[model samples]
Target: MLAANIRTQLEAYLQKLEQPIELAASLDDGAKSAELRELLREIASLSPKITLREDGADARKPSFTVGAAGQAARVAFAGIPMGHEFTSLVLALLQAGGYPPKVDAATIEQIRNLKGELRFETFISLSCHNCPDVVQALNLMAVLNPGVTSTMIDGALFQGEVESRKIMAVPTVFVNGEAFGQGRMTLEEILAKVDTGAAAREAEKIGAKEAFDVLVVGGGPAGAAAAIYAARKGIRTGVVAERFGGQVLDTMGIENLISIPQTDGPKLARALEAHVAEYEVDVMNLQRAEALEPAGDDGLARVKLAGGATLKARTVILATGARWREMNVPGEREYRGAGVAYCPHCDGPLFKGKRVAVIGGGNSGVEAAIDLAGVVAHVTLLEFDGKLRADAVLQAKLKSLPNVSVIVNAQTTEVTGDGGKMSGLVFKDRVSGEEKQLELEGVFVQIGLLPNTDWLKGTVALSPRGEIEVDARGQTSVPGVFAAGDATTTPYKQIVIAMGEGAKASLSAFDHLIRSSAPAAQPEKLAA
Candidate 1:
């Protein structure tokens, strides 16, 4: 809080310098060097307060040895800090630079009366640029209470270190340096990592960010509904819509979006988007969050992203929508986010007036064909069966579309594309047994989408297909990270169902947020 240790000045310094030549276009050689040194100087100034009182500075196995006042500092996080996490990086550096923020005096008073040692060591990789926020949040938590110290280690830099400790994800945290209590955690959730419930209760204090109480992941109906309710409660709220409208966006027409007579994916997604935006909730489109970890127990949970940006919240609701089943073909892997897209609604706009193909013969396929017909110059609907398996109405509707071509009894043998994006597909006729090729601009693989849980890394239980395993209340096997939507073992992957699941999960997150602060959970920080 000292004027010399002002965090804002250090933040501004970090904002300007970072191997500047690569970030900025033109810079004189000497100027760049001067900037780099200045940044390093600022970095060096951050007090090297070791987390958990490590023993030596070898960087080889973190030990509990005593050392001189200055040394290389460690940073930690349990989530990929991609999207909005960029802000957290400066804060973490400031905390490392011996300048803890000038928060309310009451907050510091709480830190001074701590009883035992508490350490939050976050494991992250630079590629997971989003890990910094989680790291910074933990740092803030540490400064709030002197008893707690945080350290961050690059997961890749210390592969052996993380492996020996059994880390499956890039950004993971180990409170008190213990191997137990795994999974992404929020600030309040991390406080549960301690042994004594009483001290944690004493540590309880409301934070500004908690007003956006819970972060509902996924932009599906469930996620949207959760955001609405949380916001309605005057609890701050936000929704990370990786795929806005969940499976709904891929839908052709929804007779099922609550009281609506009929709705299309784009129409429904737009409506939901507008509805959620009506609230003060922060609706971040085109963003993703990889993992969850403890930010601090200041009653506000810090959510980390893939790019190293982070946000603080009272709780989080994971509605991270689902994706279609990938054919896993040769080019499919290379051209994933390229010409190969999953949502017809999201990527469909990109393919306006271009040739495209829709894989799958089910309701989704028929729906995609009908939907793409309006956007693309031509749409080739491929189905393995001789007849359309979708409802008669949809089949007639798809057939009615002039530019849409339904290829019954045909399957895609190969997705041939150039460099990285899709150009066309090689198909085989099932009845005539003839191979054919079709030129196209994009391929919307709507065959079927699995939950987007592959990155979850088995930290929590998953279905046979690798979807996150969740109990009835949206609780995963892990304590802090919750799952919802098609990612769980939920029955139907419909818009209505996914939305319901998202809302349910949000409620569950709220319940956990309330329970995590109970006295029984406040374990002694000295526990092994």
Candidate 2:
């Protein structure tokens, strides 16, 4: 069950265990159960402080609990926690064995102070890169607080539960048997949801912060680069991000990042965060900028957050990146997380052996179809154009898939669902002037991206497509304000391009700060 190199590494990791821990497994007479037994045995043999007990009676068979010996287990796994979740399993074992977590002291105390007996179950796919964050977060919470319990359930292994609960997305979280959230969620975001007063307290603390020399909004590659460049100049740099990683978190394989031969989105996002942390940049995560105010008489721009906090800066670089563009057809929003998903890499396993449609014939759509072909029964790729826009190599690979069908000149009309979950997709045959419907269980939208500039509609000068308009120097129409990355009018929305744009925008903002000499405007002179 375990490779030799992996076993050696596991043994090294287990040496960090400070207390005795038990793996209480409840399994039946199945192949998966046998595999789990062998894996547990191999794990137990690595550490003297570890033990395995198979006489368990968990409601979910083939599951195991990890906790200190003689104590009630609070962390469990209902399936093999390998693939992207391998790190999650390692952390769970270490934390259960009295090893400290990487979370901050305040967050640890907050988790321990939670009052209710909250049980969290996270449904995940082994192939999903985003599931580990949620799984590790909940597992840590359970380890810290005796009142909390978290279980990571593999959706592919537990097909019955996935179908019965109508789960069509990865990282779908349920608390005490009710839906809590879906998609990639950070640990702070989860805490904010359960702790009602957390948002208000955070807003108050942020509102009282001092003004910055450079304030970069968004935390994607562009925002991170801008922050790094500004901080390197010895200016007080600050970054306010809604999620920090932006669209990169949803990406999977990446072979064209320049210099680096290959890397995934989540891995690159982590590297970006770590690189930015090396500087003296004040990063405030999970904060959305609602409105931007141009430089007033004080020569300081103001950014108002959704949480009622206002951040002031001498120059503001808007790097708020783009999001997955939706079809905007009927029933799409109604059944977004329920059979309508944007990420095939994350949600494809949930639709195993089911019929699904991939909207658009671009590179993303074709790639998604090719990837889903192995897991799903069939895939219908729809394109609005007469031919596919993907590269020749991708289109050839897509055509080679037997379970995939490509339909050109097809416009997605409406997504049909059965109120609770999606059932089919409606499209129009452009050439024949006829309408058609494909009976499917899932619809993956992969058209493109829409810039996150809705809030700057009236405040900043935007193109017709809603992207921020900027000059060659990354300077926006508003003085002392700049924009970069996918949110601006920069062509080619690639990670490498976004970083270059960000560095340019930060330099432009710095230049604007040093050249301008103006007095603070009166209260009456400000825009309403």
Candidate 3:
């Protein structure tokens, strides 16, 4: 069931185990259980230090326990552990075998000094790319603190529990029986939430109220750059972002960014935050911008957040980025994170040595094909257009890859998969009436980009395609307001370009401040 290379990696990781670990599975009599047990047995055969045990049948749901010999298991996973979640399972096993947590000293100290019992119940899906980070962090915390117990609940496996808890997304974390967080979060961020009693407060009421000389409205590369540049000026700068990394978080391999030969999304995101932290910028994360109010006569613009908090600023820089376009085909939503993935950088590892397909013929799609070809067994690139729209250089690179194949004038009809996971895709030939099916394990959709400018519709001027309109200096249609990055009418949506635009916008805002504050040329007293 495992690829030769992936199995080699797993074997190496297991060899580092400090002690023997057991996998206890509680499963019902069904095909899913059969498949899971088969996979577990294969994993067990990989290393003599590992073993598997059945915990009897359970009609409600399936669960698994990971622990060393003669020790009660404090870590459990309740799901299939497929797709991206496979990484979570591997990391949990390592933790059970005495792999120390990779957290900083301060965070480890906080976990060690905790006085009361804390249980982290993280709801997840096999397909979620960001879920593994939270799961691994929580599992490490459980290993560090005897008072903490962590469990990974596959949201799809326990439907009743998920509905009872009102979970609508993966990586929904609960602490001490209270909803703690949702989506990708760092270990420090989770600790802060727990310390501040944030879980007890209504989700919509949790935010900070502040005023700033400059406020950035997104957390992607552009927003982070703007915040850093603004703070360097020694002003009271602030940034409010839904997620600090923006689309960069979704990118897999970033090779075009100057100087940085190769880096992934999460790494770049952390670097962006580290740079911003060097200044006095007040970063409020996981806060979505609800509305943008233009500066009044007092020259203070107000930004309303979804969490019912308002931030007032002398200048506002809009760096809200773009999201990947979806195909809107059947089974796309049902198998999201399972077989349908958007960010190749986040989910590519899961499909190592496996066959996958990419939808689109543009630069993003061709680039994804080229990248995946190096890791996966094969990459099938499908384009709806009559001809490939990517640059000649990219097309040549794609053609040279033996594992990569391009298909044009192909219209994807449906994403076919089992009730639980995606199996393949069906597409129709636009030129002929022929239909074809490609049996692949994963699909990367890179058709196009859609700006995250819905909230700025009436607040700012937008181009026909919904991108923010900005001048060369990054100034928006409204004075004291500026925009940059993918959200703007920029020709390219690249990390370096976004960072440069952000710098330009912040400098423009600074210039506007200086010019507006300067005393207007005094009118002649005689004229008065």
After superposing candidate 1, which stretches have Cα over 4 Å from the reference?
1-213, 234-253, 263-287, 294-302, 311-315, 331-357, 370-380, 385-387, 396-410, 417-424, 428-444, 514-528
Candidate 3: clashing pairs of residues: 127-337, 252-345
- Give the top-scoring candidate (lDDT): 2
Give TM per candidate: 0.48, 0.97, 0.68
lDDT of 2 by residue, 1-528 (tens): 788899999999999999999999999999999989988999999999999999989988799999999999999999988899989999999999999998889999999989998999999999999999999999999999999999999999999999899898999999999999999999999999999999999999999998888899999999999999988777788999999889999889889989999999989999999999999899999999999999787777999999999999988999999998999899999999899999999999999999999998888999999999999999999999999999999999998989999999999999998899999989999999899999999999999999999999999999999999999999988988999999999899999999999999998887776577331322232221
Write one digit per residue (lDDT tens) for candidate 3, span 147-192: 8888888766676786577554567789889988876786756765
On a 0 to 100 scale, what is the lDDT of residue 286 in model 1? 43
| Model 2 misplacement above 4 A | 517-528
Candidate 3: C-alpha RMSD after superposition? 9.0
- What's the lDDT for candidate 2? 0.92
| Each prediction's number of clashing residue pairs | 65, 3, 2
